[model samples]
Target: MTSFPDPVVLRRGSADPQAPLVVLLHGRGADEASIIGLVDHLPTGPSYVAVRAPIAEGGGYAWFANRGIGRPVAASLAETMAWFETWLDGEYAGRRSVVLVGFSGGAAFAGGLLLAHPGRYAGAAVLHGTLPFDAGVPVTPGRLAGVPVFVAQGDADTVIPRELLDATWAYLTTDAGSLTTTWRDAGGHGVSSGALAALGKWVGER
Candidate 1:
């Protein structure tokens, strides 16, 4: 129930508010500016927005307090997600086509948002992060039935726990029944050019 300050956002591409909104979420300990560069590699026509997380961590920010890497504290995640949803509703009251693209911790937050309100988003892309698996969201089977989802994971990712990543994969591909798109490789935790290109293609197709 913490009150978060107004969001800080960096926008690129279209200036039209009616344009499709593509939200880019940074990883833990990274600011909006760190992920804003992704706009250059993503699809055009839509507005690409990168918003800074409310909670400060390291020298940057984090979406929620974590019990461990890729493990969000349920209360903290709930509080921050509520704060973010307020901002999102205010900024985009009637707007549609809101797609979430989140990296690392931000990806978990995005997954929380999508899972908590599956009907609210057009699609979500979880890049290099696990979902907020136990953070109070309903991850029951068919939770994301027919929703568009793009998931990119490195088979050798070391930053997020292996079990969490595997569980996320299992949920997205099978249990959730999402129109899931996946790109898995032997890379590590960071995004590669190939992954970015694949993301662009998926976003364009969506």
Candidate 2:
């Protein structure tokens, strides 16, 4: 497995190691600070940690190399996931439960992690983004059976290709056998207040 630097994380709300951990992953061209801000809108029970992506992109960072919006390079995704796992094992090896919340590119990364290690996270929220299709993670039927997933998307999102979004929905709801909560807004490629509220509620219930 490839090794990388420890992730730079922005933490908020609760420092108790035993408390549930909520990891927030930002989109392409964003850093940990960007997603950490969302903590203000999320539920308060769990501790939140926003992790910076390993690869340097335009002016910010990226989780992995991508061919296009919502499309990741298989090799790069695999390497990065391995790097992330190293950090996770070191910092949270025996944690009770961990949840992931991601947006845009980060959503795909979150999906990759959740799909690759179905037993790791308690739940995952994909906000206004597509899953990591063909990104070296197994997408076979029932891979995520019994997993709780929250999928929020913009009905008119043009940034993520329609086919990819449809595929993600189908995989999560059908192939993966995930217990999914879905929300679609009429906006473009951003999360709305309603979606945030719903995400908070969903995480609270987890």
Best by TM-score: 1
Regions of candidate 1 where Cα sits further than 4 Å from its true position: none
For model 1, how does the per-residue alpha-carbon lDDT over 1-206 read when each residue is reduced to its tens digit?
A: 68788989998999888899999999999999999998899888998889999998899999999899998999999998898889889987887889999999989999999999999999999999999987899999999999999999998899999999999999999999899999998899988888999999999987
Q: What lDDT does model 2 reach?
A: 0.90
Q: Candidate 1 versus the native: TM-score?
A: 0.98
Clashes of each: 0, 0
RMSD of 2: 1.2
- Where in model 2 is the C-alpha error above 4 Å? 1-3
Determine the backbone clash count of candidate 2: 0
Which tens-of-lDDT digit does each residue in 25-121 have in candidate 2? 9999999998898899987878899999999999999999999889999999999988887888898778788999999999999999999999989
lDDT of each: 0.93, 0.90
Residue pairs that clash (backbone atoms under 3 angstroms), model 1: none
Cα RMSD for candidates in order: 0.8, 1.2
